[model samples]
Target: MPIGKLYGIGVGPGDPELLTVKAARLIDETDIIFAPQSKSGKPSVALNIVQDYVDKRDIPCEIYQPLFPMTEDKEELQRSWDEATDVLYEKLEQGKSAVFVTLGDPTVFSTFSYISSRLQNKGVEVELVPGITSFTACAARAGVQLTEQDDIMVVVPQVSEKLTKILPYVDTVVAMKTSRHLDVLEDCINQDPRQKDIVSVQNCTMDDENIVHGFVDNKKYFSTSIIKFRK
Candidate 1:
């Protein structure tokens, strides 16, 4: 049996055309394609983004839908992840090259982290294909500069309290994973009195992309906000 390998491929944001050249090439060459969905029997946004580049002509595809349990059930989440890992392990054991598609860069807040960590522990050969992050996409769409000469930029995810303490010192801040914590984040930013240059970009690089500058009351499900201190 040929040795199987795992490829952690990032599909970038929602745009299919934004896929990295390497990522697109690997999708066409990999023997099998795997994408994880939030729930069972659901379509994967990551797969959908790169469907055009992926040569599904005769490749077998596996949709591993791990339960995205929102509750704080650590045990249940681990169980689901383990079961999902088993499915991947089965494919890997067959000596077939499997591509695990993830949104954004695989190394940054991507689900591939957990799977890759476990696979590495088991001595599975793995390769990573990095893609563009939503933060850069949002910045481009909003026409904002993330950094200037000798300036520091911090990328955070919905940790408003921690950000509240650090925002005063940073020149640029990009906040992600901001659906439920939108209100709190807004409150924290507004309280600083230097948040006049705040801008929010939601569903970046997609058709329904929304960009709001200054103050916004109603927040969407998936969004990112850039807080720039120009004072």
Candidate 2:
């Protein structure tokens, strides 16, 4: 039996066409595909991105729906991950090649990192393919440069409370996961000394995408706010 291998494939932002040739090929060729589901039992965005390439007739598909409203409880998170890994481990033990699809880039703020790490520590063969990130997609959709001249760019998750201090130094700031902190973010950027213009993009590169400028209402989730200081 061939030693089972794991593929951490990035399906890009939202557009199915944004799938890399390698990603598309893997989805087509891999014997098994694993997609993570957020609670509510909905299909994962990651899976949706590469659904067209997947041959439902020939391959075994596993939908591992994660417990909804991911909590800060370490014990609970660990328990859930262990259970999820068991499912993958069973496939690997059978020498089944399994591919886990992730949205945007696999490396940036992806839960795949934790899963891959646990698998590798147990001696599973693993490979990663890069995908388009929300920052780049949002920036392009907004038609703004991430950085220019001698200015620096900072990418931060919306969880950080340090946005106040960081605002003074960077030329551009991309704040991800802004849904939880939308109010704080709006107040911070609007009050910046540079008076940075803001662009908020949700589900970038996908149909039904939402983009807005200036003093946005605090409802949209899965968003990135771009603050451009280069006037």
Candidate 3:
């Protein structure tokens, strides 16, 4: 039997309507779907975004929620990837195509990157379908332009001291995963004299979405901040 292929689909930032046409079609046609969850027994956000499409599939698609723990430990992360790869490999070898759905663009800070690399090393063909990123969606929701002509932009996954160094060179900064380090981000913004505007968007495009004009005091896991600086 011929080995099946794997597709890494980015479902977009918390909006079902944002799913790309290709991604939706692939999810509908794939033999199985793998959605990653940070904790055991918890529903997957990526799955939730595309659940409607999954339900509309003509043939029932098998769904698997793989645990990809949110941790900084490299060893622990690698172990989880190894396990997920094993499961995917077995299905692929049986000629069953699979789709792995991610919260945002699969290439941007997604667990699919690790799994796709491992699958590629094991000789499994993999394809990636890009989706609207959280930062872009947040920028739209906040009504902020990320950059203009001759302007530089930088996207920081986690705000830190490095953001301070980056601020001097870039015209715009998109800070993702800001819930954990809002204090550090606030300090960086405060010290920057050229800071023009800042907006924090929580749960972009979701029903409970919120937009703050300045720095956000509260923590929200899905928060993204768009910061602009004068030239």
Candidate 4:
């Protein structure tokens, strides 16, 4: 039998409507769906974005939400990856294809990156299906262009002192996962004169979506912020 292939599907940011047509079609055709879950019973944010579509699908598929232990320990993370690989390998070896849903573009700071590399090392074919990114959705909600002519765009997964270090060279800084360092990011933006506009958006396309045209005092874990250095 031919070996089964794997797809790292990006489900887009929190909105079912934002899911790409190809991703939807593949979800219907795939034998199983793997979504990341932080807790045992809780549904994944990525899965939630496409749940409605999954429910309406004519093709039946098994959905597995694997729990990813939250810890900074490298050994723990590796063990988690190994465990995830074992599960995926089981399906692939049986000639069954699986789609792993990710919150944004699978190539961009996704947890699937680690497992995808491992699976590739084990000789499984891997495909990445692109979807609308959170930053793109946030930018649209905030009505700001990521870049203009002669401008540069920089994207960081989280806020840190490194963002301050790069503030002098980049024209725009899009910081995702801002809930961890909102105050620090605000200070960095304040330090740069070129950073003329700052916008923060939470839950970009969902019902509880929030838009802050300027500096924000309230921070949500689901938020992403954009810093525009020029007009």
Candidate 3 overall lDDT versus native: 0.91
Give all candidates' CA lDDT scores. 0.78, 0.79, 0.91, 0.86
In order, what is each prediction's RMSD in angstroms? 2.1, 2.1, 1.1, 1.6
Looking at model 1, residue 197 earns an lDDT score of 81
Q: Write the per-residue lDDT of candidate 4 for residues 5-93, one digit (tens) a residue.
A: 99999999888988999999998889999998876788788899888878887977888888886567899889888899999988899
Off by over 4 Å in 3: none
Report the lDDT tens digits of candidate 1 across residue range 72-147. 5888777767776778888888987888888888988886888888887877889998888989988888999889
Error of 2 at 214 (Å): 1.8
Ten residues in sequence with the least summed lDDT for candidate 3:
158-167
After superposition, the stretches of candidate 1 with alpha carbons farther than 4 Å from their true spots are 55-71, 215-219
Considering TM-score, where higher is better, how would the candidates rank from best to worst? 3, 4, 1, 2
The candidate, 3 or 4, that scores higher on TM-score is: 3
Candidate 3 clash pair list: none
Which parts of model 4 are misplaced by more than 4 Å? none
Least accurate stretch of 10 residues (summed lDDT) in model 1? 62-71
C-alpha TM-score for every candidate: 0.91, 0.90, 0.97, 0.94
- Model 4 scores worst on lDDT over the 10 consecutive residues at 213-222
Q: Which stretches of candidate 2 lie over 4 Å from their true place?
A: 56-69
Better of 2 and 3 by lDDT: 3
Best by lDDT: 3
Q: Judging by lDDT, tell me the better candidate of 3 and 4.
A: 3
Query: How many backbone clashes does every candidate have?
Result: 0, 0, 0, 0
Q: Which ten residues in a row have the lowest lDDT in candidate 2?
A: 60-69
